[model samples]
Target: MGVGGNFWDLLKPYGHKEGFDFLRNKRVAVDLSFWIVQHENAIKTHVRKPHLRLTFFRTINLFSKFGAFPVFVVDGKPSPLKSQARTARYFRSSGIELASLPVPEEGASAERNSLFSTYVQECVELVQLLGMPVLKARGEAEALCAQLNSEGHVDACLTADSDAFLFGAKCIIKCFCPNSKEPFECYNMSDIEAGLGLKRRHLIAISLLVGNDHDMNGVRGIGLDTALHFVKAFSEDDILNRLCEIGKGNASQFQINIKSEDNIEMDGNSPHKKQLHCSFCGHPGSKRDHMKFSCGYCAKKDDDEGCLRKPEDFKCDCFSCGMNRRQKEQKRLENWHTKICQKIAEEPNFPKDEIIDMYLCNDNGYFSANDGPHTVWGKPNIEMLIDFLNFHQHWDPSYIRRMMFPMMSTIFLRDMASTPAESLLFGQYEFDSLERVKMRYGYQFYVVKWKRAGGNIAFKVPSKESGTQDVAVELDETVNLLDDCDVPEIHQDDECSFLLTDENMDLVGAAFPAEVKRFWQEQELKDLKKRKNSASKSQENESPASSSARSIQLNITEFYTSTKVKHQPKQEESSKNNDSGDSNMKRNESSSSNLPKSVRRRLLFD
Candidate 1:
């Protein structure tokens, strides 16, 4: 399924840390297929229901609790080249003939594949419900996960597939030992390169030679050890040429049995004739035309006899064409060669820059990197997650809150304020000094005056409202002089009592002059009272009007209910009036009819 066992043997074991500790505050990209396959036996049931839902739920929950943000990547459509291996595995596992399997229609849905069963769908749904992202890859999920990690979209990839290394994954967490006290197994790219003495290119080459889903059985007689040796011995360019030569030599060994009716005879006299056989059309000829190797059958004009027109026209009785067996084999070999060439020539097709841009862009919604209170990683959506765990998972809200507070504060403060650590001490007034303080609704707010600019700035001791007490204590410890400041306790309505100082005033070395502090304190109290009185008056004016409207509606409803008198007389009087009006209109029409046509027209005009 991946690189052979010998390749894995070369990988050195990285030292362990507890799974929770190692993954804490990390963004991990998970290969969904690997997870599903790893838990296949435990999750699958006879009734076709996946019992693994709970396992997946608990696994993701554990990651979240440890502060690991996981992005689940599911496999999309399988590569066309992988179909043979998939089909072979299906036949072996299901014990059904490959012919019995439904042929994949053109543009068939990716979900129609056997690998993505209802159980996998259920797992994907569970991940989505947990507010985690599930990215459906364009091709292989492992490749996508590797890309995500390599590009810094995630800190590491969680995949057992060894091929992820070849895909350029910097770090791989092979498996999660959630129940074990020890940390999970992980591999680093640096370690892999050092231990194996192979770069990414070499790893890919080894996989191809050792046999993979794309190239089954690899080169005959070549095993993992031989492949490793070959890769180490040859440069990338040299390895590709060597592989091509080996493929051509192997193809030449197959004897071409020409049919009597085809008039193509094997020339035993010519040494090169045996090697010139057209592996497709069975036409033997010279191996070189104009110093280029040319398959005569493929080069033949359409009008020429025995020239293969379409892929379907290759049907013949020759050894290469019997039931299309050799045709399929030939195609497979060509595909392998093409892929090898591409790997050697081109870079890995990963949208690394695009993914980085997406993460760095400040966007609102799920999967946004900058969605939290600060731009630092893992701070966004934390509150929503804490709430979810507290209510749904029945976790103690206080415990969860306590666990996240310090981590969040450290990252938030590091990002939000770039104030140097030394400057945090009030005793060191090189840049700024604590000018004034006010306590409002259990929060201690202070004003800092920058000495150089004489600019005043306000700051709260505890930034977050929920954990004010702890943050306040931490602030006091950080700035010991805060305890000496005479902070006045003010009511809730007096929150904005701190005033901006004069722009030109210079108090570079003065430590909160008593006279200036007293002046601001008196002015702050007067402003607070004024604001409170105006706020009360606005509320009182709004409340009386609303109350009067409610009373008027109630009175109207009561009057209507009490006055239910009969309306028969009103209906009778209205009917009589209608009859009189109709009679009067008829009399007017009779009077107009008696007049002359011109006179009636003039009267109507008048």
Candidate 2:
């Protein structure tokens, strides 16, 4: 049998007994539920790392020295059906303002209490060293640990609570030893039964009648003594029959607690009956809509709450509504899309370039894309799309906000085709133009649209090989430049006042010496000169190149569309080729390193 708790301290009294040596090799399975619970709090307090070094990790080190191995099992999230009462208690204890629900503080007192239930890092390290598989039950981690013992995978279940008894583990070792104590006390289920003068079934019934500490609905007014009487006298059939009768008699009242006011036996056979069931499917699951409990099928089908079902006699996948439910989902999605489009339209800061591009081109690249049968990019708003990118370095959120403008509009239409017409349609723009723009804005080319007359179209295309490496570096350079510049304090419309401010224009002109700099500075000064004359609005000056040209550059080596091979001149055995006129002619025919000055400037900056 596995030995746990302060076994070392307890066994100290029974030292060196032959065969009792099995205690050393017992391979004790320690319940890590408390560890996880405590860890969540420790991590918040910044004591988790230290705790790992001292407690769990230290145990591993100590055990290794003695040639003993221990396995630790962590507690998982509370099961929906099993822990509803406990959850309700926690929620009540939190006393959080309803408003805090939307913006819960990171380390709120409630979270700290919950984290206290999470085991620290050392538990993780200890498990890794032991090479034991970590098991997670469908709903509760603790239940799985108890089940492991029940199934005989573990010699015995070790835990701080008595809940494991409900799972029917043969033996449980509670508080075996925390630090050090003699007799290293452990209470077997049989011993508990003997002490209480009740059978195992009676014990389970009492637990159920009283309600589990985690989640249970205690039959009101059914005290332990009254419950004990029924457990001793009634058979399973008798108890179930009475329960059904009582339930039916009160069916019209829409509640089941009246009969529960009279004490009766508790049974473990159907511990789940009192808990919440799927309203549509009648499945005995809790938190079906919370956190990780989402139904993948329902999510994939349509992300609406109505798709989740519960019925009294629920069976099979479809809820009571069946096909009608599906039809409703389709209508819901259409309505949702309309509202989303309207919201985007109202947001002034939304990238106009991206919006215009998506609207003009029949592609959903800025929002979503479908790549053949298996893959699909989910739709997202401009902020969501931009935030999806992984940044290499810390960046100001505002700079990224600005670049998301034109970047959002550029759609990736379709995969490149070798045919001339197709190439001209999708791949006509120099790859450099595309790469430089994306690099500067931290955008992935989402998808391209087919230039159809109507309807949304999109195609996936991989970035071209030649310009791929430069994208990251160029983007980083642009970010660095933006970081150095002083951000304009005024809004986009107050451009004239901002430009005329000597301090502001000094910074702006130094960053970009192009057309934008000249226009803003010249107008700012001119408008300020004559207070008597009406404020003259200068004609809108257009920059020959778009705003993107501020950071764009071209590589000369990539100017050629295709590679042309030239034969290498064979070296002469003698000094003849070195001295020969033909060799000189071949050398002169090769490409030149230096280009015309205007050509060099154009390639570098144009």
Query: Which candidate number has the best TM-score?
Result: 1
lDDT of 2 by residue, 192-259 (tens): 55545554344444554445553243455455555555455445334433333333342233212211
Question: Which pairs clash in the backbone of model 1?
Answer: 372-380
Evaluated at residue 430, the lDDT of candidate 2 is: 17
**lDDT for each candidate structure:** 0.50, 0.36
Give each model a TM-score.
0.41, 0.32
Judged by whole-model lDDT over C-alpha atoms, candidate 2 comes out at 0.36
Per-residue CA lDDT of candidate 1, range 247-356, in tens? 44433333323322234444333332113444444455432331243344456444333434236554444443442443345455445544443443232321123222
Off by over 4 Å in 2: 1-22, 38-51, 58-69, 75-77, 95-122, 130-132, 177-183, 197-200, 213-217, 236-606
Q: Which number leads on lDDT? A: 1
